[model samples]
Target: MYIEKIQSPANLKQLDLKALKVVADETRKAVLNRVSKHGGHVGPNLGFVEATVALHYVFNTPTDKLVFDVSHQSYPHKVLTGRVSGFLGDMEAMDAVSGYSSPTECPEYDNFEVGHTSTSVSLATGLQKARDIRGTKENIVVVIGDGSLSGGEAFEGMDEASELGTGIIIIVNDNEMSIAENHGGIYKNLRALRESKGTCEHNWFKAWGFEYKYLEEGNDVEKLIEVFRSVKDTDKPTIVHIHTEKGHGFAPAVENKEAWHYSMPFNVENGSSLEGPEHESYDQLLSDWMLQEMKKDKTLIAVTSGTPTAAGFTAEKRKQAGKQHVDVGIAEEQAAAMVSGMAKGGLRPVWTVVSTFLQRAYDQIAQDLCINSNPAVINVTGGGVLWMNDITHICLFDIPMLCSIPNLIYLAPTTCEEYFAMLRWAILQDKKPIAIRIPTNGVNHTTEAVDAAYGYEPKYKMVHRGSKVAIIAAGSFYQKGENVVRLLADKGIDATLINPRYLNAVDADTLDSLMTDHQLVVTLEDGCKDGGFGERIASYYGPTEMKVLVGGVKKDLYDRFDLQQLLSDNRLLDEQIVEDVMRSL
Candidate 1:
């Protein structure tokens, strides 16, 4: 009732301290309740609730633009900025307030819709510069995470903002960690500054010529409001270090901040989620596989760009794994070049990056690593927008898009078992930079995968047969496409379906035969439809009479989506594909 009554930030500012604190508490409770029912980034958003409230309450919004880093934590901002119901309805939020900041999708969201860590500071800085050029007078406050500070984009923006000496508020929400615990040289500096009683003067920001204000007590809402009000009228770039416990008020997440950074449905009373076994993550598998390889082959090292945890590489394992475990801060470009050196120095370096984030290192993957034929094993995980949190096209369509290059080799696995085998094969073999764009469940973990060279399978490895049209599937989405086959057979439309295990490596003979004999070729992949393997395959059948229907994703998934609706939008359903096939026939 109180939430509904407060329509705007002006109304929120009118609330007394007791009401303000109560509002903050209720907002937290509401956010936790919403995200827990259908899992979202809980910790980062939770940590910034009070500070976010304080900023909006003190400043004017819509007119006074507030940008969020990666914007996963913008739920509170959405709730305060004329979006009362934006934070609710997890299942419905897909078409509404996205998990990330999306202005194009929704009017309430700002210009940037980001999920990848960092890049906010740069965006805010550019917007501020443009505003100044146009003689527009509105406050620009960009909230960046401590984890994102490790990224080069944030630094570049911060450095540029410092030079411009413009009045922009850079709120550094220092809860720490980028998906997992942050890795690199800067995290150490942050720890020192946090512990130094203000003695640790490693001024990374001042070095760039920005005014700095360090306040480690982010939980104290009153103090935060005062600090925000103090910098409200300042005329140069200013940094506010607001320290808050991630997963604050929740004991479980506070204790193991790394693991509790996000969670699924749970009992809110005890703060314990549904218990489950600790299945291995891609990071853990790669670390374990690397350790085993180091035992056999001494020249092995590992490299990561800030996200060791997302990849499942624990700190202990990184230390104990092999000859070298390099955490190159938030710089993917730097990490790319480092791997090349390791390869030339007679050491095999493996880089484990999530498929979506690997796009940052494309030039390096091509020029620095691929041009030299460096043996770097890039372990990419979380490839598709299967879940509701379709923030952006983190899709791996680009990796396969880069297949036009000369030397690089790409691979994919159906289950967790093959991941180890793939890793072993990648490590032992000498080739140009090898990027294995892995789906979440890359290998079947049961079998002990050893280094055995295997031929790259076609994008669609036909596993079943039917009298009707053939279905082609790629990436982790084969599971869904496989189900469609069963669903079709239940309707008496027995169809042939194949898993394109190697998204990049097309099976020439199998593809040719399928195109000729099959009534329809329905191609499906998780990446963007344009410049993907399916489109390439479609192009390969140049000016053909065969009816070919392609499905996956268009490019950027819009604000609202339903599975059936998405399929309808893409013409992916049986009826659509069959109708198109009929027209071609």
Candidate 2:
């Protein structure tokens, strides 16, 4: 096969347009085979196969750097860069490479380890500046999607790139979708440009001073090569806008682009999921609750930053929401600030986002929401150690980042009852900006139904009271605390077990009271130890006689770590906690 012969982009350079098309076909099959078995970004890889192949054939990559916006669309790029074996060979081979582009795996091929969207233009601009400084004339290209263009960072970078007046090729891949359908006014202009065949006076790229070129047939390798050849070795900033199908060459993905954007292991023949039925998730619960609440309150709104599916807001639910559902495509910063405005305007705004993505809006949370004291409910879903072991998507840092922000109440709920109660309180209370870290594991109803009317009092709930030792657990780690309590009881050491629901602030009164009977106070959190819930508790008891032991993952980037092994390494096991307490005593 042509794909097997392609060891690198250098090999791709040797191939003609016809041979390149053959390689693209082979790459698409490999992507489909690997993605269907192991699960990955199916539609993006399939859509961008020809574009990727054409770019590698025309550009001298590794010298002429190429950066992908989200890197979810980098599967085709990986195949061309001597990594086809990972996709085409064995099932285990797919595990050898990450879903996103990683410099660690192949420094020569992948320039950045990017998972977030709208970052390529900014990243590639930096590379261009660095090359200019080094007196190098190599090209710098950034491939960004239409959906990602809605982000503020992309505009900021594009604005700067226009002024540079150097050789920078900005390829705008207009696939007409993000993870879901594209949102924002920019998409409207994109549609106009597509309809007018790039002759529209309201040219978004041209307004930014970029020399614009558009291709009607983006999936055509010959057309893409012609477009690339026009801008090759040019000494001016240019944008090559190519209109391509999102899920090209795949009928199922093309018909339902959003659902096929990313998928679990599926039956290749029918495109049906191979995994069993999905359990009821916190996302679904939040969505259902919001729908019910919206019926009661007209001013209630559900907000998401491009990723509506993450919050379980299906297209049907979004349609039902009508004017109440707000999707500010790929703009987390805007979403945070907008929700703050909505709260100030006497509206109940609930902004649900993935924990990792919310990090981008830290400044917005601190300045726009917390400083103004807006009663906005930010539901941080996927806030702990996730099974998906990618460094860029890790949800560990949310606890530390959110907790440090002043006037922002960060709550950790262990069970569905607590989560619902916290959500209810946050939505109803007009006191301060609140963020609730949604439980990651399956639903556990250990505790009774929480009182919705009860105001948040920054107090830890004592599950079991005992003398000598007190174990304080945060959110999902509460189960571990219960297990430790059981193990302590078996050893005749009846320890006190406490669940510190409020992660940001300490319940000083309750903690001080524990000092009378408890000799040791142990704090456990399913996040980074540095600046996390455990550290706050440790600081609270610093001057006191009570010894504090903080148990959590270390302050480091944990890449694809086994969750159980990570817990054991941190001495979070029941036996280990019991042994440590015994030794301290």
Candidate 3:
């Protein structure tokens, strides 16, 4: 259709308003076609299709930089910018492109390799400053969502961007939702602005030194182009707040906005998931346990930084928990500090976070939570080497960053029983700030009795005790240690398998015991080897006669990679570990 004919912004500029509207329609279809077959962000892209189309039509892109915040909403932008083949072509073509914006893929149009939220304004300000320094005058436009404004960095960017006193247009795409429902006090002002059709008396932007404009019909192609054209090459820093539906065109996504924010492979005809029903997960287990605990104790609360669903607190479940469940919007720093405050106030707070997002709150976690020794339970999901291969979302670095912090006990549970046992202990004990790395591997259960006092008495559990070779595997990699033990047995070498439940510290007593029978100790962790769980083991046995071999991912940034190839390359496979043990022996 119209999308096929248009290759670039130059091609889009040739089309009139009518043709532009037709192209927006076609772009939406292409997005649906691609995302329906291959899983991706659905609501964000569906909502921003018109804005992307209008921006490309109005501006001289690549020359006039257009920076997208998060870049999950850049799918429609991708379809129009000489990459429609990825969306409209075969499965191979779809697999070629990543879900998030990548500079490597399209250096000209996609300004940054972004997957995280609330960074566009800061990034664009840098671009504008550089251009100004070079005596060039290319318009720098930043497209950021209303939910992103809650982040500390976004506020910092806006504050600094206003002081520039030059031409910079910040487009606030008010979709009225983050990954889930919006939170924080900033959203209340956004609601007021939306209700008053941008004529709100109390405008946060105006107070922050920004020339403000508003658009009620954000989905209208001609209207968006007109507003975009008005702000083009302006002398003052400006904010164009545009209100749009989150899942505008799709009925299911429009109705259930949060659930459809990011979709698995789904049926296009009726928005049913093609990936089938979700099985039992650690998130679900945690949600159930938390609800049970919250019922018994009124002061217990569940906290999240925008991604409540990651903790299995769906909208329905959230309503059930009521005020007990807190979403701090896309602000992890605030979540960390607030959870610490909650703990200091004697309220039991469990802050659940994804591994990659935890990077933002490192300072707060160290200074506020750990330093204060706040009695808070931080449940870390997606902590290990994950299936998410995007460079921005890689989870291999959390171990090094987190485990180094003092007064924090990071526990790694291998099974569901052990996980719940650790969680139960972390919640009840008001001693120190404890973070549990929720296992990323498939949900596993153990028939063996799990000690209730596991975290309290931090020690390694020896599963299969034998001879000269010892394998101390942490968390999900404990399963890998089991397979490696079997492989070693096949080679006529009986190996000792140990599960080091805690990541932050080494079990000195267990290691001293291992020295009696074991000579070569192989530490396997589902994370980066350098400064990781394995390194702790290596450091522990440094002065001893025992030899230590650390098995983990190499220290490097990877993007959209094959999981099997990554494991094989890193020697994370059971066979690889067995081979390494053989060589060491």
Query: TM-scores across all candidates?
Result: 0.85, 0.98, 0.98
Error of 2 at 343 (Å): 0.8
Tens-digit lDDT string for candidate 2 (511-539)? 99898888999898888888999899889
What order do you get sorting by TM-score, best first?
3, 2, 1
Give candidate 1's whole-model lDDT.
0.71
lDDT of 1 by residue, 80-197 (tens): 7666575554455523556677776455436677777678888888888998899887888989888888788877888788878888889888786666677667777777767873
User: Which has the greatest lDDT?
Assistant: 3
RMSD of each: 4.0, 1.4, 1.1
Show the colliding residue pairs in model 3.
none
* lDDT to native, each model: 0.71, 0.89, 0.90
Backbone clash pairs for candidate 2 read none
Superposed Cα RMSD, model 2: 1.4
Regions of model 1 farther than 4 Å from truth: 86-95, 104-111, 197-199, 275-291, 314-325, 393-396, 416-419, 440-451, 454-472, 477-501, 505-522, 543-548, 571-585
Worst 10 residues of 2 by lDDT: 446-455
